[model samples]
Target: MSKVIVLTGAGGVLCSTLAKALAKEGHKIAVLDLRKDAADAVANDINKEGGKAIGVAANVLKKDSLEEAKNEINNTLGTVDILVNGAGGNHPLGTTSNPHFLKEDLLNKDEGFKTFFDLDSEGIEFVFNLNFIGTLLPTQVFAKDMVGKKGCSILNISSMNAFTPLTKIPAYSGAKAAVSNFTQWLAVHFSKEGIRVNALAPGFFLTDQNRTLLTNNDGKLTARGTTIINQTPMGRFGEPEDLIGTTLWLCSEGASFVTGVVVPIDGGFSAFSGV
Candidate 1:
């Protein structure tokens, strides 16, 4: 069944893959991103492949930008039946240099050391706004057209950090946690309105955003990445393609009874403890 799907951050590696997959399934895609060129490139690829798509520049942080994009999408692709909130990432300033804090490091701060105390408030706020508020504002604008509309669904892109806060990237962890919480809140709030809200808490996927952190310049796994692989009982990092099946299933009628749930696609990372 072809439906109108609006995907934020479709310019990125993961969401773009999802967008292309959805388009292959006959959904009209609205690829929204802050970068017009990036969004257009994705849309153009989809169109070239005989899919319907339009790229729109949208700043999810601002309501006016989202409203404008909404109007354009409504005019072009029809009312959005599926909204995928994928416009979120962590900022370097919000990260700590070490995964854990050492007592001596507090007294003898290295030049490159970014301890939790060194975390910038502006960076924290930016991360929170990008991940949490970013999702909220888009839903505010697009979900309006979905009201009382059958088969309408929303999928938020959360992270495994949302379940258990990872080290160093505190801002991202906290913001994603809020996203998971809000997914449940919105699901219940819109239960009577026929809008289903759910979230996907992805495990470690090697996207450009975290590629540097996860791998060295020589392309070997970094210590943190090794730890992640070891923790994941499946002994592998997830590919963007790994998420497509789950994504399509969640958007399909098969998940009609499912809402307010954050599904983990982390290759058993969420299940196994170090033991």
Candidate 2:
């Protein structure tokens, strides 16, 4: 059965792939992004491929924007059956240059050396709100349509750091952890309401948001990227397509009883203890 799905952050690499894949499965998709052109591009590609989709520009942080988007999606594609909260990112301000704290680093004047103490409050808050609050607001808006409605579910984007904190990205780690927690909370809260909530805890896939950070312009993996690859038992980063199967299953009746679980899509990165 076809359903209407709303995917926030659909303009980017991962969610865009998800949007197209879901559209191919005969679902009407709302490709939403902060940038109008980004949203339009994804929606256009889906439509050109004979899928039902519409591009909508809105900020995930704003409830008014989300409400407006809900109205538009409702009018154009019927009530939403699935909502994917994929609009979240990290900020430079929330990251530390060094993976571990060094006392000498605080005295160093190096431009790239940022200690945890140097982290900006604004940057930390920005990343935290983007991941956590962004997920909250969209659910607050679109899940309304799913109340008492079967075949309706919500998928949130989380990170592997949610399970274990990675180096340098404290803010993103904390935020995603919150997302995972909220997923469980929401699933239990909505258990009888016919609205299922879950999250995807992606380990590491190269996205535009982290491309430059993960790899140099020459396409060589940076130190952090190299560490991630080495740590990942699969020996390779995940592709966007890797997420489609899990996503489709969760949104389908196959996962009717599955809710509040954070499925890690990272090539066994989360399973290995790196002994």
Candidate 3:
């Protein structure tokens, strides 16, 4: 059975992979991204593989842009049968140098900005709005078409930081925590509507967004990235393909009873206690 799927941030590495997988399964995909060229490229590749898709450019932070994307999806792919909220990320300014703030750092302008005391209010608000409100806004715009539709599901992209805050990225951690919360909230809220809401919490995937921080230009893991890998039971960073199984299962009839859940695609990173 062919279904219509709408994926936000389709230009992104993970979402791009998911869009291709969903398209391969015979779904008509609406590939949405803030970057038009990236989205267009993904959609073109899918089409070349003999799948149906339309690339859409939409800023998740803007209501009108999302509305326009929704319109394009509706007119092009017959409304969304599956919604994947993949539009989110962290900002450097919203991060801190350490887990806790120190008094001396407050007096030093350079040091202050690097410490927890340096986290800018505007940057924090931006991260919150980007992940939480970004997901909420899209759901509000697209879920209307999914009401009473059988096998319709919503997939959100959460992070390992959501389960536990990582050092330096307080804003992103908290924002994704809200995303996890909203996933459960919406699942219950829309239970009667026959729509399932769930989230995929990826452990650590090497993507362009985090390339500099996670790996050197030569492609070896950085010190911090190496620490992450060592902590994972699998002792490896996740690849984009690691998420496809969970994504496809959730979108298929196999996951009809599953909702309000955060499925971690991490290789036991969330399960370990560093013992």
Best candidate (score: lDDT): 1
Candidate 1 at residue 35, lDDT?
98
lDDT values for all models: 0.95, 0.94, 0.91
Clashes of 3: 0
Q: Number of backbone collisions per candidate, in order?
A: 0, 0, 0
Could you list the CA RMSD of all candidates, in the order they appear?
0.9, 0.9, 1.5
Candidate 2: pairs in clash: none
Which 10 consecutive positions of candidate 1 have the poorest summed lDDT? Answer: 104-113
Candidate 2 residue runs with Cα over 4 Å from true position: none
| Colliding residue pairs in candidate 3 | none
Cα lDDT for residue 150, model 2? Answer: 85
Rate residue 68 of model 1 by lDDT. 97
Q: Write the per-residue lDDT of candidate 2 for residues 1-275, one digit (tens) a residue.
A: 99999999999999999999999999999999999899999999999999999999989999999999999999999998999999999999999988899788879898867899999999999999999999999999999999878889999999999999999999999999999999999999999887888899998899888888789999999998998999899998899999999999999999999998999998899999888
Relative to the true structure, candidate 1 reaches a TM of 0.98
Model 1 spans with C-alpha error above 4 angstroms: none
Measured with C-alpha atoms, the lDDT of residue 174 in candidate 3 is 98
Residue by residue across 1-275, what tens digits does model 3's lDDT show? 89999999889899999999999999999999999999999999999999999999998888899999998888887978899999998888898865566788667666436877557899999999999999999999999899877889999999999998898898999999999999999999999988999999999998887889988989898888988988999998899999999999999999999999999999999999999
Of candidates 2 and 1, the better by lDDT: 1
Q: How high is each candidate's TM-score?
A: 0.98, 0.98, 0.96
Tell me model 2's lDDT, rounded to 2 decimals.
Answer: 0.94
